[model samples]
Each structure stands twice: as C-alpha cells, then as structure tokens.
Target: MKLSIERAALLRAVARAQSVVERRNTIPILANVLIEAEGDEIKFRATDLDIEVVDNAPAKVERAGSSTVNAVTFHEIVRKLPDGALVSLTDDGASGRLNVEAGRSSFALATLPRQDFPVMATSEYDSTFTAPAPVLRRLFDKSKFAISTEETRYYLNGVYMHVADAEGRQVLRCVATDGHRLARIDAELPEGAEGMPGVIVPRKAVGELRKLLEDDEMKIEVSVSETKIRFATPEITLTSKVIDGTFPDYSRVIPQGNSRKLEVDASDFARAVDRVATVSSERSRAVKMQLDEDRLILSVNAPDAGNAEEELVVAYADEKLEIGFNAKYLLEIASQVDRENAVFLFNSSGDPTLMREGDDTSAVYVVMPMRV
Candidate 1:
C-alpha cells in the first residue's frame, strides 16, 4: 500500500488516533491503528477492545491496500516532518514492515494483519432521536464534574440520561448523584423521543461523546438499545455498551421543603468559599458558614494549620443559622450557577439543602449537610 498526504493533514489525523492509544499494551495490535488506502482516501482505525474510532481523510491514494503500524511511533515521526513536505507511506503486501518517507526523514514500523482488529458489534436500536449540540453539551458538561470516581457503586460513576417531567413539561433530563451531591438538568425533548428508554450512559462514553458535540448548532443523531447506545454526527458514529446496572432512584434525595433562604452573588460566594478553604487540610474540608440578618461569614479552622475567615453581604433575612459543608462540594455546586446570584434553601443544620439558579427550576442541585 502507498499514499501521499500533506504533513499537516497527516499529523492532525495521527494525533487524534494516537491520543486514544494507551501507554501499556498486553495485546500487540491493540497499540496500532490500521491504515488503508483506496480510491482518493485513506482510513485510520484504532481500538482498545471496547471502543474503536476510525478517521477517513482525503489523500493521494496509490497501490490501494492496507497495513497496521504502531500508532505512537508513526505519529511521533510524522510530527517531526518539515512543514509543507509531502509524506509517503508504503508497505509491500508481505514485507511485514511499513516504511514512512518525507523529504529527508525515514522510519520503518513493524506491521500486523489488518484483519485482526476487533470491531464493536452492531445492534438493533430501540430508539433514535436528535438533539442540538449545545443541548447535549449542557446535559453532560454541567453534571460530569460531579460524577463519582468510586468503583464499588459502579452505577454512580456516570450521569444518568433519561426522559422525565419537569415543571409540567416533558423534558430530556440528566441526573448524577454521589449520595452526597446531585445535579439535575432539564432540556426540551426532541421529536420522536417520547418513548426513549432511560439509559445510564457510562462515564467514558460521556467523555467521548463530548468531543462530537462541540459545535453549538450541530444536530446530533442518537440511537439507544437495551445494552448499547450510539451517538453520531455526519462524519462520526460512536457506539458503546451501557453499564448493566440500575440507576438509583434519585428523586427521593432531592430536598423539597427547605424554608431558610439565602441569596448571594454566585461569584462572591464561590470566592469566599475558596478563600476561606485555604486553611483547610485535605481530609477535613468542612467550611463553617454563619448567617445573620444580612451578613454571611465563611470560616475554616484546621488545628494543624492556621485559620481563615471571609465575609459576604447576602440577602438572607431568616433566623440565624450555622452550617458546615465540604469546601470542594460547595465550590463545585456554586460554579454551576450561571447567573449573578445563587439561591440556597436550608431546612436545619442536619438536612440536605437545595440550590438553584436564581429561581430557575430547569437546573437545580442538592447537597447533604455536614457536621462542623
């Protein structure tokens, strides 16, 4: 097989393909991306057994055939090639090695059988729908930061995507909970999605799917089944196995009747939470919040370290309240508020509190309180 591709075009495709290749490999071909040339195009495919990605780019195809090469080594070689130079990749049908050539640079990669690469199985999808890129972006972007890293629960390690009624309107919803904090987001449902099954899209799929949804105006075609889910654009189709576990019933954890209300500027509150947390040790990140008529005092005290305190003017006029929360959790939830003020609802010193974006129900959050 032989093909000539410009250095920039070759490097962009190889960089994307190699980033998916892991550093350690027990299987030889798992570290390679199969390259094939036919017509005027060349295709590059890479996989780690569970996930596979293929990129097809226009090239000067010659000799029309396929070969496998090390993804990292080939990418490193192409990256060093001089700008505007023409790169030619060639391998005899049975040489067992692929030769790369530029103006004055040369390298050979050991080739493997292209037929040995594993591809994901295709399935009959139970549902298909389309959503705007930004709609899907907000669904995952706002909630992914709260995804649990704990492997024991496995189910909580991903954002739960499903259809639910929000404020008397049918909306596509995403919910993620780590038992201590939860993010619930609602977006308008697309057509033909009324019967979509609730699927717990895994963490890695959520990340891979994010790259395809960057264009704010692009419409994404999504397919779902009992065991697998697929997301596609005109140029890319991604299919992955869904986690085979039931997502916990998250609605019961959402607080409803918290009466004490505190309204403060979101940026001011986040800065105060961060500034006071400087004195906290890793294990104990509890930040004590003292609320009076219209003043909020944020303080942190660690015996081994020093102490920190900051004050913020808020709109709280309820009875005096003192509460403690994990500094990290507070900072995360506060960053979700896009508006100027973040409204927090409290019940008592020991109850889960509710947070929302300035009276908007579309995006709401809940956090369990911690003892100081």
Candidate 2:
C-alpha cells in the first residue's frame, strides 16, 4: 500500500485508531491497525475485540493496497512530524516492513498481514435514527460520570440508553448508577426512535464517543441492535458490543416523597464541601450538612486530623435536618448542576437524597447518605 497524506490529517486518524488498540494484547494482530489505501482515500481500522473504530482521511493514493502496522508506533511517528508536512506510507508486500517518510525523517516499522486483523462483523440494526451532536452529547456527558466501575455487575458498568415515558411524553433517556449515586438525564426523542430497545453502552465506548460529539453542528447517525451499537459520522465510525445483562430498575432508587427542601448556590455549596473535607480522614472523607431554617453549615471532623467547618446562607424552610455524605460524591453531583441554584430534597438523615438544578426535572441525581 502506498499513499501520501497531510500530517494533520494523518495524525488525527491514527490517534483515534490507536486509542481503540489495546496496549497489552494476547493476539499479535490485535495490537496493530489495518491501513487500506484506495482511490483518493485511506482508512485506518483498529479493534480490541470488543470495540472497533475506523477513521477515514483524504489521501493521494499511488497504489490500491492494504497493510497492517503497530498502531501506537504509527501514531507517535505522525504526531512528532512537523506540521503541514506530507507523510508517505509504502509497503511492497514482499518486505515484512512498512516505510514511513516525512521530509528528512524516515522510519521502517514491522508489518503484520492484513488478513490476520479481526474485524467486527456487521449486525442487522433494529433501530436507526439521526440526532444532533449536542443532544447526544448532553445525554451521555451528564450521566457517564455515574457509571459503575465494578466489573462484577457488568450491567451497571455502562450508561443505559432507552426510550421512556416522561411527563406523559416519550423521551430518550440515559441513566447510570454505582449504587451510591445515580444520574438520570432525558432528551427529546428523535423521529423513528420510539420503539428502540434499551442498550447498555460500555464505559470505554462512551469515552470514545465523546470525540465525535465535539462538533455541535455535526449530525450523528446511531444504529442499535440487540447485541451491538454503532455511531457513525462522515469521517469516523465507532462500533461496540452492548453489555449482556439487564440494568436494575432505577426508579425505586430515586426518592419521590422527600418533603424537606434546600436550595443553595451550586458553586458555593461545592466549594464549601471541598474546603471542609480537606481536614477529613482520607478513608472516610465524610462531610456533615446541618440544615436549620435558611442556614446550612458544612463540617468535617477527624480524630487524627484537624476539623473544618463552613457556613452558607441557603433557602431552607423545612424542619432542621442533619445528613452526612462522602465529600467526593457531593462535589461530583453538585458540579453537574448547570444552573446557579441546586435544589436538594431530603426525607431523613439516612434516606437517599434527590438533587436537581432548580426545578428542572430533565436531569436528576440521587446520592445515598453516610453515617457521620
């Protein structure tokens, strides 16, 4: 395969492909990226058995052929090249090496047979829909932080995407939880997405999808089947297998009858929690919230370390309540509030608390309380 591509274009394609390649591979070909050059374009494909990404870049093709090379090495070489320089890749098929040349620098990388690369098989999608980039971005970005890292409960390790009824209308929703906290975000359902089956998008796939959603004007084509999910754009395609398990019914986890209400500025609340937690025990990192009338006091006490306390004037009219929570969890949940005020609903000191941005029900968060 022989082709010449601009350094910027080459670097963009190779960097994306290399991210899908696993560093430690049991199979030799799995560590390499498949490069195919044909009329006016070159394609870079990489997979780690579960997730696959293919990136296309415009190139001047000298010959129509295909080759495989170490993805990490190719990316590093292209990244270090001078900007605007044209990069040439050539493989004679006779020699076991691929030649890379850019200006005065030249390097030869060992090549693997293109036939050895395992490509994920195509699936018959049950649902296909188009959605604006910003809409999809908000759905995933707001909920992915709560995805569970525990491997045993594989179902909880991904964001659940499905169509659900919200306020008497069907909406596209994404929900994620790690038992301690949960994030549920809703967006307008696109046309033809009414009957789509719910899919658990794995954590790695969610991270990679973020790159494609950076362009606000770009439109993303999403295809989903019982076992696979694919996100495609004009230049890039990402495909992954859905987690093979059922997500827990999260409705029960979100408290509904919480009577006490507290409205506080999200930024000020997060900062106060951060400062007070500084002197907390490393293992616990717990901060206590004492609410009385319109005053809220945040305090952290540790026997070995000094204690810290901060007070903020909030809007709380209900009876006094004291609750303890992990400082990290509170900071994370509070930061997700986009609006100036974050509303917290409490039932008791031990029950899970519900939080949302003002009165916006579109995005809601639930965090379990801990003992002080």
Best by lDDT: 2
Please provide, for model 2 over 127-226, each residue's C-alpha lDDT reduced to its tens digit, 9 standing for 90 to 100: 9999999999999998998999999898999999999999999999999999999999999999989879999999999999999999999999999999
The lowest-lDDT stretch of 10 consecutive residues in candidate 1 is 47-56
Q: Which residue pairs collide, candidate 2?
A: none
- What's the distance in Å from true for residue 161, model 2? 0.4
Clashes (backbone N, CA, C under 3 Å), per candidate, total 0, 0
Model 1 RMSD to the real structure?
A: 1.9
Candidate 1 at 198: error in angstroms? 1.4
Give the Å error, residue 55, model 1: 2.5
lDDT of each: 0.86, 0.94
What TM-score would candidate 2 get against the native? 0.99
Cα-lDDT of candidate 1: 0.86
